[model samples]
Target: MADASGLELVEQALGHRFSDRTLLEQGLTHASAEAGYSYERLEFLGDRVLGLVVAGLLLARFPDEDEGEIGRRFSALVQADTLSEIGGQLGLADHVRAASGVVNDSILADVVEALIAAIFEDAGMDVAAEFVRRHWELRIDAVTAPPQDPKTALQEWSQARARGLPSYHDIGREGPDHAPRFTVEVHVDGAEPVQATGASKRAAERDAAAIMLSMLDPESHG
Candidate 1:
């Protein structure tokens, strides 16, 4: 396959001049592309790479924070929304190769992970670790306290009331392949199942949990 146009700009943005540009190209191509390529495999490895680096960074930054507290912060930092936010900040939407030639938050997040794997493949984990730390450090610093992610909040709420663990299901999906919306349903023991939609399953599940929490405690909407 021919090189993606203006690959240097992407390199510039990543702060790493890839030795094997094909890896970078593959990272940018979405499954929807006719190029018969996608970032799925790379993203699998990239997800682990990102997790390892971020986990280490979190440990170093919060020496006094406990496991549960650091875990919540790690969850917040590594979520797809954070990845998409960083991707947008880096102007990655313009270069992503998708079916509609457009990149949404979900796709951008995948691309970001794929790019990390590509960097790892091109050079080594050290380089990829550096990339992750450089872009993600500020976000880490900004987490002054561990956040109560909706999933954690809902789980705690349910367990506190002897509801066992809340269940999540991917009840529906709609829209074009390039930009799909997932509808998730969260089931508590006694309450009606709550449904919510988002650009990705995790996000939809989070929203569903948040809705359930809000409904159960109207005053906690903040």
Candidate 2:
């Protein structure tokens, strides 16, 4: 509610200050423009800005890695889930000025991109790149890292072993609509189904598949 406190805290989290005070305010704005001017345009720019910065960082960090490896790692790092996780870690949800009914991790993730766009506009590419670097430094090297999606890995393994395609189902659903908890069952070829729950259906499916993957290949789990 207090702009001063909000500004101070966000600046601390972002490790930079806006020369244009309005840009910072715009970064916190949501598409619910009745609440304020939306940051949607900024988000678009930030998405590309973030991608370029990450790509440059990846190129420098993993010279030995082949193009396919780089592309895969880049995909992993820039996915919505990963960005949303980063947004939550920075407590961007608390700081964003969204409407009363805005309740989704994907929106929070978009806010992160919008915020990055705001930074790029307010400051410059250099500072924006630095901001990305500071937040994503740990993951830069990991761009060359192997895939972490257990479900896909498990599917490949099963297919190789003469098993048919894996299937997943939303077996159970619970909790409120805004934040429903989903239970998923992953069925590997001719194997007993493994179940898992998460905040979303996709996540639940991944978890269920992860458990099956672990059971099928203990080495992958570690």
Candidate 3:
């Protein structure tokens, strides 16, 4: 059985009540918990749902912009960092169930996605889209221009200064085989090397490069 108070709190945060409370409970469940009951499948469906809604929202909001520009905005909007930030705002970490007794940003982000799937399953696409628009509109409206890819931006910054390209080294890997976490360090010519972790090597490298960029010019990147 699901905890009534906890479900109520999550429903309030999501602004959508679930008809099948089990769906919400399953969505909040982590793989680390019960073997057969995890949010992975819901997350898979939610990922596509989120992408479609966000893409539609971008198209409607920026009718004059070309595909490339809208694509950039779409990427930024659906990135794990953005989802995790929204999850934190909703206090999802407190509600998610994990065997380790700790929930990381990735888990929180996944839970948020799973919750979106739950809403879609319980109600319909319209309700799911409305929920997404309400929570994500402020973020979408705040952007004056499409953001650059962190990796490309870092490379451009280095090349403009006649500095050699950034180098990324894989420092470590952890977690289960199905969900490995990678640690990567980005080294610039003169500055201190910065490290970051992610669910994949590419993501870790990208995060490291972003950190390096922020360190070099806090005003521009930060």
Model number with the top TM-score: 3
Q: Which sections of candidate 2 miss by over 4 Å?
A: 32-36, 99-105, 142-144, 170-184, 195-204, 218-222
Q: Best lDDT goes to which candidate?
A: 1
Q: What residue pairs clash in candidate 3, if any at all? A: none
Clashes of each: 0, 0, 0
- Name the weakest run of 10 consecutive residues (lDDT summed) in model 2: 140-149
Model 1 TM-score (2 dp): 0.86
On TM-score, the stronger of 1 and 2 is 1
Error of 3 at 193 (Å): 4.1
TM-scores for every candidate against the unseen true structure: 0.86, 0.77, 0.87
In the predicted model 1, the residue pairs found to clash are none
lDDT tens digits, residue span 77-107, model 1: 8899999998998888888888787788999
Q: Write down the TM-score for model 3.
A: 0.87
For candidate 3, which ten residues in a row score worst on lDDT? Answer: 213-222
lDDT of model number 2: 0.78
